[model samples]
Target: MESPATTKDTASRTQRPEGRPGYGQLLRTDGAWSFLLPGFLARQPYAMLTISIVLLVEHTTGSFGLAGAVSATAGIAMALLAPQSGKLADRFGQGAVLVPQVFLHALTIAALITVASTDAPLWSLFVAAVPAGATAPQISPMVRARWAARLQGSPLMTTAAAFESVTDEFTFVVGPVLATALCTGVHPAAGLIAEAAVSLVGGLIFAAQRRTQPASARAGDAPESARSDQARPQSALAVPGARVLVVAVLGIGMVFGGMQVSLTAFTESIGRPGINGLMYGAFAAGNMLAAVAVGAIRWKRGPQTRLLAGYPALVVAAALVAGTAQLDPWVLVLGALGTLTGLCIAPCMITSFTLIETLVPAGARTEAFTWLTGAIALGQATGSTVAGQLADRSGAGAGFLAPFAGTALALVVVLIFRKALHTPHSGLVAARGVGHRTTVTVD
Candidate 1:
């Protein structure tokens, strides 16, 4: 017979923590919010960077084509570097990877600003963007991977994901507005300088916090690590089905990237150059609302199946954006149109992420998610590159057609190649069951 004390101890050990923790649990269990702050600050600069560069370059060269080419080059560099950066983080740790990259990224921004101020060779302006993008920290992917890791298969993860999407859309929307204001009210170089400062401060703080970083594969800096490339498990990319999903993500990126240049030109064409960020914000607001709505209820369908709806929804959103081009600037019709499209933004992105999570093995969390970021950047680069030329020639309105075409192509891709999205029983259950209570709402 066990002693009373021993029996009591056994019960305490076996009993699990009580109650389901929804949104707030993540913060309470760990100081996640504390670290997320630095990550947010660091990421805000990314939104500022391209717009600031475009403004500076366009002002200096008096050519939107040159500006667009620079943005595209930087974006391409980011797309290629993102996955490699994630791989390093997974092998080493976040601190080692982030700290150095942040410093380098800051330096690159400072150099670009100097060139713009001094009226240095225009070629140098383009050169500066290369390092600016290559050194951009892998913060977003790291944060998402952390959430997925912490949440595991808990139903609350959907809420967490929705929250991430809402916050991200909000930041991207706000970042540009702030950038525009600084450039318009202050000096054009002010935005880039601000971005550098934010990146440095926020990144250092995040790196110092070692408690929350994802576990690395190796113990330390050793030639022979615990897992070698040859011995490692196959990556998420190895799954043939993942090809369609990644390509779809790439298409989405292109649309957003193209829209950025076109929207900037559109504001210029309308003689309200300051309104670019607000327009994007209006669209983002709709996205936030949708994310909130989705988080409130459980879905009856699998996440993969749910993704099919997003492609068409995006198509409608793009068409509406193009439609508003014909409306008078005084109509203020964009807010309603922007919000309408926002309704679909969260659903589309979150579903894609959830599907990726379901398909990828947990070990490759950071790398897999980072690839998503790369795809987005690549698409955006393509958009900005093409749209810049179109805007220079045909006008901003014609450039709006880029996003419409991109999204339309996205829809077609999913329709024809969507068979790969079929999830197994476990993935299906994860979406509908595990904490989801089936409640229907016309989504």
Candidate 2:
């Protein structure tokens, strides 16, 4: 019973406006591109270098057990110290904290290489790992916070996150191969040295950017506020949505960690050790492709819905991977597809972070985000330890199922608690007028 004119008006209002830039448009922005370049340069090679060093150490020692233990120790150290580092960044600016840390990190890496290449006792190797891990700069979180601060409420923030996720995928996809080639092609020691040098250069370059430097200290503020003002933002964790998101991401991290070892086992069991890298590369490729695709689309639904959907999909993907392991003939093909199904990863992460930004107050932003990072590290460490043990015992097939089961359990818990944990928009909206509130949006 609607008039033709009225119907047309409604349709016009609901339809997406023409000439509106999509994800590509956002990426094309000066600020977006400006941020992207340095971030990519700093992170890409860093990932490759780190992974290569780990693999080299394991190969040289001829002990997976030692490698796993060392990696886990590092992971735990990072998790424990991340919050403190993040808090420092929020108070004194990331650049201030980053510069010194990067130098220390570089030195630690060099020392590790020297000690590792020698016939140092296992205790010496373990002792060196503690300092190396402690000195590791929290670069990823700082970069993320910088982008959030610079870009604010624009869709560009999401785009930036998508870009970061793509970088992560690329790093994982290419890093292992690059690392292996470097170690074998050159020397294992050379790889560690290269990684340390690159990290130092990258960190210094990022710090040198005048625009990206930390804010100058304000005059006449209370001791507490003054301290908090200099630090990275911490307001987000106080919000219910951001809190739940952090928890969920931790679950995802655990699943990823467990899968890492399981994938290695599965590849070896199938008598195709070389294909192990290929399978992992394929998985990362799938995630990259999906992230690009998601960015290309215009979604009417909220990020929360997207995240909820992605979690279950991961569960299904894990199951598919497990099922394929039983069908030896089709394992490779199914493995690829199963990996593709996990394409939702980047988009989900992007959405969750964007939502966190929207919900958290400016004062607490950095700390909240760092907490998410720490949770991920913790989950990964836990997952890796448990999964490695399982694989060592019952066979690789059972290892593959670990992630599936863990993801399923986590998803169920989140869904059951969703209503209680759902963050209201009122607090975020109310804070907009305050100095600490940067942006507020409701969907």
Which residue pairs show backbone clashes in model 1?
254-379, 286-342, 287-342
Candidate 2: RMSD over Cα atoms?
8.4
TM-score of 2: 0.77
- How many steric clashes does model 2 contain? 14
Supply candidate 1's per-residue lDDT for 164.
67
Q: 63-85, model 1: which lDDT tens digit per residue?
A: 77788888888888988988888
Deviation in angstroms for 415 in model 1?
0.6
lDDT tens per residue, model 2, 92-125: 6767877898899888877777778889888777
Report the number of the highest-TM-score candidate.
1
Model 1 alpha-carbon miss at residue 260, Å: 2.0
Scored against the true structure, residue 133 in model 2 reaches a CA lDDT of: 67
Alpha carbon deviation, residue 397, candidate 2 (Å): 3.9
TM-score of each: 0.86, 0.77
Residue 443 shift from truth in candidate 1, angstroms? 19
